[model samples]
Target chain A: MKDTKRQTWMGLLARADAGRVPELLGQAGPSPDFEWLRAPEIGSVMVQGRTGGTGAPFNLGEMTVTRCTLRLSSGEVGHACLKGRRKGDAEAAAVVDALMQTPAETLMRSKVLGPLAEDAARARHCRAAKAAATKVDFFTMVRGED
Target chain B: MYVAVKGGERAIENAHAWLAEERRGDTDVAELDIQQIREQLSLAVNRVMAEGSLHDPDLAALAIKQARGDLIEAIFLIRAYRTTLPRFGTTKPVETAEMACDRRISATFKDVPGGQVLGPTFDYTHRLLDFKLAAEGEPVTAEQRDADPAPVPHVTEFLNRESLIEEAPRDDTPPPDLTREPLELPAARALRLQALSRADEGFTLSMAYSTQRGYARNHAFVGELRVGTVPVEMEIPELGFAVEIGEITLTECETVNQFKGSRTEPPQFTRGYGLVFGHSERKAISMALVDRALRWEELGEDNSGAPAQDAEFVLYHADNIQASGFLEHIKLPHYVDFQSELELVRKMRREANAQTREAAE
Candidate 1:
C-alpha cells in the first residue's frame, strides 16, 4: 500500500463519527474472519505544540485514544489507532484497514470510506461558512485623509 | 512529629453518602445531564480541559456535573482521571497555521490574510439581561456565507518575512514533562510553557493584568488571536506514517512585544505566544501577556521586581489543584501539633511568672 493513500483512509477511519464506521462496514459485506493480534486498549497520546507556533516544539497536553490490531484469516494484518474510547469503532476500523489491502478494496472504499469522507467534507464546509459570515472587511478612504 | 490519628471511618462513610445525596440535589428539579453541560456550559468545560491538561469533552462535562459546576474541582477530577490512562506516544507538533479558523482577529493589523473574523462574539452585545431568556428560550440562528477558500496566514509570518520580529529557531529537543518530573526553577522556555499551558486561568489572568498596570509591562500588541480546530496527528510504528488521530479546538494568541533589543542584536519585536484547549480568548490573551512578562531575563529586560516577571512566583502558584490541596489539607486533624504548641505557650508563661515572683522577693 502507498503510504500517503493509506494515511488518507486511516485518517478518515480514525476521525469517523463513533459507531459510524461499524454501520458503514456492515453495509459493505460481512467482514473477513479475523483474529485479534492485539485486543482493543484504551490509552492516551500527548499532544505537542510549537513554541511560537513555528518555533521549538513543546508538550501541550494529552487526549484519550484507543487502539487495536487484527489479522485476517488469509493472513493480511490491519491496525487501527484512533481518538476516544470506542472499542467497536477500533475493531471495525481495523477490519476495514485489513480489507483495503485485499481484493475487496474497491467494495470497501466505495461503501465505507466514501460516505465518511463526504460527511467530513460537508461538516468542514459548514463550519468554514459560518466563520466566513463573521469576517471583517475594512473600507478604505473613510477616514481623515480622504 | 507526625502521629497517626484515631477513628472516623463510619462518619467519613456517612459524610460521603451525604455528599452524594447533596450532589444529586432537589429530586423535583430536572437534573442537568452531561450532554447539557457539554453543550450549554461548553466554555466551562473548555476551561477545565485547558487547566486539567486533558482534552476530552465528555469527561470534562462529566467532571463539571460531578463537581457541581466548580471549575477548579472539575479540573482536579480530570487531572486524576488522566493519571490512569497509559500513554501511547507523543504527536507531531500541531500546525496552527493549518487551523480551520472559526474566529481570527488582529488588534495590530485590521486587514490580515485571514481577515478579521468575529465569529460568535459577545464583544458588541448589550450586557443587559434579556427577560425572554429567563423563561423558555427559542433556538438561536445566524446567517451563513460561503466560506472563502483563501489561505489564512499567521500574522507573525508577516513580521517574520520583514525580519521585524526576533527569530524563533526550530528546536526538536525533548521538552521536560512536568507531570513526570518535578519542576526545577530557572526552568527552560519549553518547561515554563508546559506549566503555563495547564496553569490556573484566573491566576494567569491576574498576573497578566498586573503587567498591563505597569508591573514589568511588555508593550504588547495583539498580533493575532485565532480560535479554531487543528488536527492532532501521531506516528504509529505499525503503520509507519503519521495519521490524524483527532481534532481539537484551540485558542491561540500571539503578541508582538516592543523590544529595544539585547547587547548582541539591534532593535526588533519579540513574540509572546499562548495556545490553549477550546475557545477561550480571555485565557489565551492573558497567557500571552504573562508569557511575555516571564521572558524578562531572556529578552534582556530588567525585571523591576514584579511578581509576574518572576518565573518561580508565577509557575509555583499558578496550579489550582496544588494550591487548593495544600490549603484544604489544614482542615484535617492536627491534634498533636496543636497540643505541642499549647504546651510550649503554657511553659513559657509559667517560667515568666516564677521569674517575676522571685525577683520581687
Candidate 2:
C-alpha cells in the first residue's frame, strides 16, 4: 500500500472509539514493545472559520482534543490526535500507528484498520440514509408561455 | 480635591452576599434548578445560546441561573466559557438547505413543497395574561402528529429556476472569523453576516426595523423561515474523509429583496441570509434584513447613510457584551479623571473673568 493509505488507516484507528480499540488490538495478537515518546495529553485548539463561508478568516471557537506521540522499539514513530478527552484512545491509536509502519503492517491493516474503516463507513451510511429519507424533490408546473 | 477612595472590599463582599440572597429570593419558595430553567424558560435559553454562539443548553441554563435570570449576563458567561474551550476543527459550513425542519414557513408561497408547519409559535396567540399561571396550573398536553419525513426544499430555488433572482455564486473560500481576529472594514458580506448572527438581538432587531421604516428599504419578502437541526461534519485528513461529529438546532431565514439593477445590469431579486444557533426566528429574520441593508455597496446601490447600511457602525456596536462593558464601566471609580476635569473647568472660568475685568477697566 502507498504511504498515504497507511497514514489514512492509522488516522481511522486513532479516531475509533477508545473502547473498541482494545478489541481490535486483541484480534491483531501480541503487542510489540514501544516506549512513550510523549504520553497522551488533552489540550484545545482554536477553531477558525471564514465569514459566510468565503469571507475573511475569524476565530469561531475552541473544542477539546486529545493528542499523543510514541515510538516503537523497532524505530517507527507514530502520532495521534483525536476529538474529545480520550487519553487511552489517543495512546492506543499512537501504538497502532507505530505498528502500521513496522513488519506487522499487513497484520494491523487486516485486523485493526480494515474493521475500523468498515465500521466508520457503515455509521456514515446509516446517517446518510436517515437524512436521505427526508429528501424532498421539488418540481414546478408548466405555466403559460412567457 | 477628590482623594482616592479605599476599603471597598468589605462593601463588595456584603453586596455579593445580599445579591446571592436576592437571587434565591423568598425562603419559602424553592430555588430554581438549572434543568428547570433549561426546560421551562427555553426561549430565554435559546436567546442566550444564539447570542453566546454556544450550542450547549445545559451550560446556557447554568449561566442563566448564575446571572440571576439576566439574559445578556448569561450570554456573557457563555461567551467567556467558550473562549477557554479547545477547538477540534471547523466543520464544513452547515447546509441549511438540508435542514430537517420542525417549523417551516414562507410568506411568498402558500403551498410550499413541505406544507407550512407552524410547530410551536406565539405568532397567532393573543396578548393576554394567563392569570392561571399565577397559581399552580394544570399540565397542558400538546397535540401530536407524525413528523413529516421529507426535506423541505428552499423557496428561493423556485425563483432561481426562472432566473428571477441574482445568481449567488458558489465559492468555497474560508471566511474570516471575528472572534479570533480584529474586525477590519469594508467588511465582506460573510463577515457582516457573522457579526449580525451573534449580534445583540435587540440591537439587530432595531437595525432591521430601521430598514422597514424607509431607511434603505429593500421591499423584503420572507422567502423562507426554517427552524431545524443539521448535522455537523468535520474532515479528518488522516482518514481522507469527513465524519459526522454531532447535530445542532439552527434557525435560518432567507429574504428576497427588490433590487433595482444599475445601468450595467437588469433588475433582479437580491438575497439576505440569516442563520443562528438555536430556535431564534425573530433574530434570524432581523439578521437577514440587516444583512441585505449592509450589502448596498456590492449591489451597486447608492449609500443611503442608514445605520443598518453602515457596516462598521453596525458590527462594532451590535455586540451586547462589548456595549454593556463600556456602558457599565462608568460605575467604577473615576475620581482622578473627574478631579482633572474640575480643575480644567475652574481654570477656564478664571481666565474668562480676568479678560472681562480688563475690558471693563
Candidate 3:
C-alpha cells in the first residue's frame, strides 16, 4: 500500500525506541480520554524472506510485536503495531495516531511524531557514517609481476 | 507394562535451588545485566537470534544470563517462549534490494556500484588479547564519513544480464512453514533454505567446510555478502494498507558456484544463497556453501554420495534442539529398559556355564 500520513506516523511510532513514546506523549499535553477498542496485546509475526534474497519467498522466522486499537472520545479509531512487548509504547502510539486525525493533529504531530522522526533519522545517519568510513577504495599499485 | 514412578519431588526441587544459586555466582561481584550481555556480548545475542529463530535481543540476553552463558540452553528457552506467542500472520517478504546496508562486499568484482563497505568487522583485527580490557576498557568511537545513499544491487545480476549465470526463477508459491509442517525429504529449495537459516552453526559450518575440502566441491566464490538493516512491514487488515512494524538486522551471503555443462543445460555459474537474522557473516556464508552442495541432484550433477549432498541426512541432523533432546534424554531415568538388557545378558551367561559343565563331565 501507498505511504499515507497515517502510515508514516505509524511506522515512526513503531520503530521508536522502547518506552520512549509514552514518556514523549506524556509531555505532549493533556491526555485525551480514549477507550480501548483492543487492549495492548503481545504477539508474533512470522517474518518472511525471498529465496536468494530476490526470488521465491520463504518464511525466515518470527519476531515479537505488540499491537493495540483505541477509539478517542471524539470517535476516531486508531491502531498500532510495534516491535517488541512494550505495552506502554503501544498505548501511547495508538493514542497519538487517533489524535493525529482530530483537531489536535497539529499539536501532536509537532510535539510527538516530529521529535521521534528526527531521532530515527539521526540514528540512521550515524550508522551510515560509521559504515561509510569502512568503504574500501582499491588503487592499482606498481608490482614486479605486473 | 508401564508404572508411575514418583517420590523425587524434594530432590528435584533442591537441585533447581542449587542451580539458581550457581547461576548467581559470587554475589560480591557486580551482577551481569541483560543490557551488558545484549551490547558487549552482541555476537552471542546474534547467534541466539539466528538459531533460536527469534529476533528479540533483550530476551536472548536474558536467556543467556539464565542459562549461564550456555548458548544452546539459551536457544532452548527462546524456542519455548515462541511456542506461546499467538502468530499475527506473516509479513510481506522483506526486500533486500531496499536494505540500508552498513556493510556490503563482493569478491567477484574489484569494485562494485555501492563500493565495498567493510562495516564493523573483525577480519583485520589481530588475535592478540587486549589485557587492558580485563580492567575497564575506554569508550571507543568509529571513524565517520559521508555515506552514499544508494541501493547496492546484487552482484549476480550483472552475470544474469549477460546470460553467464543461471537465472533464479520467480515463484509466487507461499513457502511451507518449518515449524508447522512435518519435515519431508526431497524438500523444496525454500524449505531447505529455511531449515539451513536456523540450523546449528557448528554443524552447518562443518558441512560447508566439507565442500571446500573437495567433498562435492563446486569451486564456490563469495559473490556478495551484505550486513544491514531492513524495514519489516506488515499489511494490516483493518487499515487496508501495510505499516512498518519494525526493522531487523540481516546477514546475507550469495555464493557463485562453478557449474559445468549438464546434459540438459549449458555451462554457467550457479548460485547458493543464505539469509539470517542479525549480523552473522560466518553463519550466512556457511549456509550459502551448504545450500550449493545440496543442489547437486537438482542441478543435474552427480550426487557424489557426500554427506552435505544428502538432503535427508543434512536436514535431519541440522536442528540442535532435536539432536540435543534425543541425546540429553538418555541421562534420564530408564530402569526398565536397562533392567531388561541386564536380564538377557545374565540368562545367556547361565546357559553357557551349564553347557560347559556338561561337556567337562
**Using lDDT as the measure, which candidate wins?**
3
lDDT of 2 by residue, B1-361 (tens): 5576788899999999999999889989988998899889988988897788766677788999999999999989988987876555676666666666767788988777776667567877898998988999889845444343556678888888888887665667677777767889988776777778789999999999999999988888998888876655556555456544344677878899998798776898888887787789999899889988998888899888988888889999999999999999998888898889999999999999999999999
Off-target runs (Cα >4 Å) in candidate 3 are A1-3, A144-146, B355-361
RMSD of each candidate relative to the true structure: 1.8, 7.0, 1.6
lDDT for residue B6 in candidate 1, whole number 0-100: 73
lDDT of candidate 1 over B222-283, digit per residue (tens):
99999998888999887678988878899999999999988977899998989998988898
Clashes of 2: 19
- TM-scores for the candidates: 0.96, 0.75, 0.97
Candidate 1 vs candidate 3, DockQ winner: 3
Using DockQ as the measure, which candidate wins? 3
True contacts kept of each: 0.81, 0.11, 0.80
Give the Cα lDDT of each candidate.
Answer: 0.90, 0.75, 0.91
Candidate 3, B1-361: lDDT as tens digits: 4557888999999999999999999999999999999999999999998899988999999999999999999999999999999999899999888888999999998778888899989888997998888887679889999976667788888889989888877777899988999989879989999999999999999999999999999989999999999999999999999999988999999999999979988999999999999999999999999999999988999989999999999999999999999999999888888888899999999999999999999
Error of 3 at B298 (Å): 1.5
Sorted by TM-score (best first), the order is 3, 1, 2
